[model samples]
Every structure is written in structure tokens, then in C-alpha cells.
Target: MRRSVPMQRLDGLVDPRQGLGAAEAQARSARYGLNVIIPGVRSGWRTTLADTLRDPMLWFLLATGALFMLIGSYTEALIMLLALVPLFGMDAYLHRRTQASVEGLSGRLATTARVLRDGSQRTVPAETLVPGDLVLVRSGEFFPADGLIVAGEELQVDESTLTGEAWPVRKQVVEQGLFSHIRETAVEDVYWGMAGTRQLTGHAWLRVTLTGAETLYGEVVRSAVAGPHAQTPLQRSVAHLVKVLIVAAIVFCLALAWLRYHQGHGLVDALLSALTLAIAALPEEFPVVLTFFLGVGVYRLARRRALVRRSLVVESIGRVSCVCSDKTGTLTEGRLRLTHLLPMSNISEQRLQTLAAAASQADSGDPLDEAVLSNCPPPVEQHILARFPFTEDRRKATMVSEQEDGLLVAVKGAPEVVLGLCELPEAERRDWLAAVEAYSNDGHKVIGCAYRTLTSEAWTGANQIGG
Candidate 1:
């Protein structure tokens, strides 16, 4: 909440180089409690019970019982209403099961954090972090609290939890005196680093600004956990079925009542008789059966440490056959391994890996680049002088590196695109194309690597030079 950036306010709270002293941090931690969001107080059994009573099937059953009471069938109405007892009890039990499974996961706090204290980096418990703490987060680590990025490498983060998007977001350093990033919601607010988001690719230095409910990630979790969830597919289907059944019951009852009146029966007597028959014809076991089945699913899922926010959603999840993942493809163990390398006859395996690494952004947070860097270090004597980043249309990344002899152009990307960039004999090209096809058939994610020398005529403006 403080408007002062980390450096200017060194006298009171944070020292630019040392962050907060150990004693000062402890006092601040006491002022702001542990960074945990507890939504169970509002979203527990009461909310689930309310949702169950509002269900279409239960609503219809209650309405029918109330109609029986209007017709002076007190004993029958009471019996029908009493039947709801087990339904409510069973729903409550299932709600507890699902809630218990996720409680530990939702309330989990990061056990360790790397922070600057007394002018030296110290590893401490994440929950002890306060607003003024200067934190350093690296690749594959979750941020402990919300803060503003002061400096970092090619930092990228997975913000899918907040945006429901599957792509990595690149973060930029905040220039001095630019305070607009604190409240602004733009994706370009590269200075903002929210708590709980995983840092995908770089070392970042951030000054902690907010924690607990005040942080963006914490707010999202609070709303999702405590508030009413949107209707799921199964809920909609059951409601539609209930509506159709209610309409049919009304139509059949009206016809029966009309026929009775036509046969000279008294109007009131005929109407009462029709209503009774309609009530009896209704399937009283329908609600009981459906609720019982979903309850079983909730119990089973809870045993495996999985929780469905709504019990009815258990049925929806069961119906899934082929689930296509988001644009990033299937999720893995947060790493990638370079399993194979097939190089050209003119190049060795290390040479091929070196060229691929030269084309990649160092610590760019891209899995492909990380895999290549792990395989071989980039040529030590060469460094990129110009870069053309990859895009959907480009399907490749190209870098021009200054070498001792000349400028070396290194490229890596989809095989078809990379092959077009290389000047090879037609026969060799065809043979390589066949090889690519065979490799793809074996389920390998192949990337093409190539290098070429810049011509004397290509020496011109940076952007105008050929890749």
C-alpha cells in the first residue's frame, strides 16, 4: 500500500541493499498475520445445503407436498415432506467430504523463501515475509507474496490460475518512479509479480508490496472458494429434465380432470381426484436415486485427495472421454529432456547443439530452449548481435552472432521451415524430409537446427541483414 518504491524509503522500512533487518521483519510479520486465505468459514456446509434445497427436483417435490396440504391432506403432505430428511443429510455429508480434501491444499504456505536481510540473502519461511521484504524468485519456484519487479532476466510466469490462459507471461523491469503498475490491471504491468504464480524462466528481484487477501492471487482464490459457483453441465441437464416432467404431469392431470367433469362428476371432486392421481404418478424415487449416486462419487474422489467443488459435477467429470489440453499440449513434470539428436553430415552432435543454443534466448523460460541449453553450451566466443524472435507465422527463431571469421546465422524451428532456410542438394533435402517424417511417426517432437555464414553484401543495417 506504500507509494514509495524500495530505494527512496530506505530510512524507515526497507534498505535498498539489505531489505528489512531481521528484527524489523519480525515486527512487520506480527503486524500482518500469516499469509493464508480461509474460505471455509463462508463456503462450508451451509452453502452446500442451500444449493441442494434450490435444486429443481427438490423444489418440485416440495411444491407437490405444499399442494397436498392446500387440499386438506395434512397427513399425506407431512409424510411427503418428511421424506426430504435423508436427502439433505446425505448432501451435507458429501459436501464435507469434498471440502476436507482441498482444505490442506488451499491453505498450504510456502515453506522457504530467499530474501535479502542485513544486506545478505537469507533463506526463511515464506509465511514470515512482510510487505517491505525484498525477495528473489528463480526458475521453477512459486512467488511467496505479491510484489513489483525491479530487475530480472528474461522472466516468464504461468498466470493460468488467474487468467485461465495456458501461455507464459513475460515480465519487464519497472523503471524508477513508475508507480502506475501497482493498481493497473494491464497485462503489460510487467512490474507486478503476484503471489502463488510459478516463475517459469528467470531470476527476479521484487520488493514485496502485498500479502494474504490483498494480493491478486489471494483475491481470486477467496472469490472462487467462497462464492456461489456457476451452473455446471450436469446441473443444467437435470433442471431441464425436471421442467419437462413437471409440464407432462400438469397436462395429464388437466385431461383427467376434464374427462371426469364430462362424465357428470362434481367439479371440485373431479379436480381433487385428478390432482391426487398426478401426485401419485410422479416418480418419487428419482431425487433419491440421483443424489445417492453422486454422493458415492464424492466419497470416492475425496479418498483419492481430489475434490469437486460441487458434488453434481462428479457426474460431469465421469462423462469426459477425450480431454484435449490447452495450447501448450500435455502437462509434464516441469522439465524437458533432449532425447535424441540427428545432425547433418557436415556437423557433429555438439556443433548442432551449440547452434541451437545460440539461436535460443538464454533462460527465456521456453522448454525447447532450456532443453537445448542443457544439452550443450552456446559457442563461448560468439554472441548474438541481432535477433528475430519466433512467432506463429515465423515458426522459427533466428539469431545473428558475431564470430571471428564472420557473422554466423543460427536458426532453429519446425523442420519444414528450417529446411527451407538451408541451401542443400535436392537429393539430400528429400532424404532429410523422409527422415523427419519417420522421426515424427515415432512420437518425437523434432526441432530443426541450422547455421549459415553471412555474405559480404549482407553487411548493412541490423534489421536489414539476412538471418
Candidate 2:
């Protein structure tokens, strides 16, 4: 979600809790068009053909092919025209990939939002939203529209999409209650939830004060991404070489024709002789050879799931040595993997992973839990008595499960939290803490794991383990 810029909140403008009625929403939707910036379809065959023909090499091929047909060399003409088939097909394939990416992006930009309509929460299309509507936004979801966060705590939003900031921004609750409103507050104090940005961690109720072009992100949407005429160095060099070859072909053809005419040859004979030499000297094969090589590069890249927007980029990729990234979803898959295991002397590597998975809820949709679950299945036939969700204050989660022998308690969280809760020798704790620091210095995200077995005498209930 984009960070919503704080705006003047007029008193009596919103109900905050009841939100707008269904009929009012329908009327507003009719007044304002759909919240779309550039609703474009896939590139058609004509567009693909046009883009392919833009290659200067292909233009030379077409001219050479026409000349061949004029000279009745049907075989050469056929070969030149046949070369165009792969160029067109390559472009069509890449454009299809590019269109799919664009559609995926558009899907993210517009999503369904749960909002209060006539005192009841209903899932509605984001584009149908209007100003004065109250909506709910949760973690890992984009804010449907631009609005002010009326009530929420510990709300963290990923404003990097809009602000270009690498860090997550925490939002505060609105200080004044409903109807105590008539103040122009600073942006930092008043929590604003804008469209096109995502909520990173918390849930919030926001009053939609702006929609479509009225929102901050809507301004970005109005300014569309432009595709300019660009060329790689290889392409520029090839084009330059082709220009020089054409000039030389023309100069030699004119000089030879003038000499033959002055030596008593007929104008038609001199012209045909010059034309024949020009056709051979033109070196039209230069472009065909270059196109074939680059087309193969584009094909290889496409097979690797790399979307080559332009064939010229294929050459540039071969020259790339280092790639600087911001570690965002666009840069990488952003999926967590259990790469290493640091077990205590008494614990086996398998036991460590089992305990970590035991503390995790498979259905939680948390990346850490999923990564652990991917490695090992949870303990079988174990009934969960109680489970504590991770919170910012606690910084850890605990779960109690009933097994055949007795009750088992498992915990996983930040290293510091786990070390503090576990009963360890002072020297052992310091050693493990030092290990954790080493992992941190190596740029690894470390999660500490611990488990405890409880006998019947000690297995009271959830309170005995956590409280």
C-alpha cells in the first residue's frame, strides 16, 4: 500500500464505524469511473510485427529481398524472407511473457477489500470503493484505496513501493475519536493508508477519503510507464557498420557505372552491370548473421524463464558481472529457506528441526514456519493443548502438545528471547549468544529453538508452561 499523505479531517464527515451504505456506494461508483490507470490488453499480432520490423537489420533484409525478386533470383529472395519468420516469432513470444508480467502487476494493484457497508462487513472489489467508505486492511495485503487509518496499533506498512524507502514504516492510531475531528495534523502523527502500498504486519480500519485519481498513488498511475527507443551497444555498432557498408556500395556502384558509360557501353548495360555489383557488394548477409546470433541468445534466455523485453538486451546480459539488488520481491523470490542448523551437544540435527517445526503452525502463512515445515513434518498424533502466537512484545511463540509419553512444550523465536527463557548454564548461554552474533554478522537471520519434556507431575495446563 502507498503511504497516504495526511489530509485535513473535517468534523462530521465520516462515521468511522458504520461506514457508507450500499446504495451510497453504488451511487458513488456511478459518479466516479472505475479506479483504473492504464487498462491495456495484450500486444496484438500487428504490434509484434511492427516491433520486429523496427530492427534496422530486418529493414535491410527486406530491401535486399526485394532486389533479389527484381533480379529473378527467387531462391535468394525466399531465404531473405524466411529469415524474418524467426525474428517475428521471437518478438511475439517475448511480448507474450511481458504481457503476462504486466497482467500480474495489474492484478496486485487492484484487489478485493473487506469493508463495512450498512453496518456489515462485505468483500467488495477495490475499484468500487469511494471516499467515506470504511475498510479493513491486514498484513501482506495491499491497501485498496487511499484513506486515513482511524483505529489500529503497531501498524507497519511497506511504503517502499511509493516512497522508495527500504525500511518499513510504523503507523500510530488516530488520537481524536470520531466527531472530535477538525484538525490539520502533521503527516507523521496522523496514520494514512494509501492505495498501491501494502500493509506489512498489522490490521487497521481506515476511512477512505480518496479513491482513484484522488489518491497519492493514483497520481503515479496517471503517469504511465513509458517505453522509449533504446538500443544496446552491439545494436548501435551493427547499425553503424550497416550504414557505412551501404555508403560504400552506393559509391562503388556509381563510379563503375560512370566508367562503363564513358567507355562506349550502352546506358542500360552499364546500369545493369553496376546494379549486379551493388547487390553483391552490399553484404546484406552481415545483418542476417547478426540477427541469427542474437535471436539464438534471446531464445536461450527465454528458456531459462528470463523475459527478454528486447532482443538487444540479450547482448547486455552476457556482459553483466555484478547485480545490485534491494532484496525486494522484484529483485528476488523472497522465500525463506532453512540453510543451516546449529544444534546443542545433546540435540541431533533432526531433533532440532523437529522441535522448530513443533512450535510452528503450518497454516499460519508465516515464511519461517513454512520453511521449517518444508524440511520436516510435525510430530504425528500429537494434540495441541494450547499455542501462543508471536507478538512484537513477546518476540517468541510457544506451543504445548500432548504426546504418548507426556506433554511436550516447544518454543521458537528471536535468539535473545529463546536464550532468556531457557534454563541454561551461564557459560553455555554466553557461548550460544556469541554464536548467534556470529550468524548475525554473516548476514543470516537466526531463529533459536528449544523444547522441554513435561512429566505428569509437571504438566498442569497452558499456564504451567507459558505463564
TM-score of each: 0.51, 0.75
Residue-by-residue lDDT tens digits, candidate 1, 1-467 = 22233333223433334488889888877887765543344456669788687766677668778878877889878876876775677677766755664465454335578999878999988877887888999877778877778777667776655555545677777764454333333334467787767787678887777777777777766665666656667667666776777788888889999989999998997899788877777665566567668777877887886656677678878888997764432354444679998997778887888888999876555667778888786777776678776655567788888887887888888888888877788999999999999989986778888877875467563533232
Kindly provide the TM-score of model 2 when superposed on the true structure, using C-alpha atoms: 0.75
> Any runs in candidate 1 off by more than 4 Å, and if so which?
1-18, 37-109, 164-167, 179-187, 229-290, 296-307, 312-366, 369-446, 451-467
- What pairs collide in candidate 2? 1-197, 1-198, 2-197
Best by TM-score: 2
Give the alpha carbon lDDT tens digit for every residue of 346-462 in model 2: 889999999998999875546667789999979888799888756566677788888889888999999988888778889999999999999899867899988888876786665
lDDT of each: 0.72, 0.76
lDDT over C-alpha atoms for residue 226 of model 1? 67
Error of 1 at 320 (Å): 13
How large is the C-alpha RMSD of every model relative to the true structure?
11.0, 5.1
Model 1 TM-score is 0.51
Question: How much is the lDDT of residue 263 in candidate 1?
Answer: 91
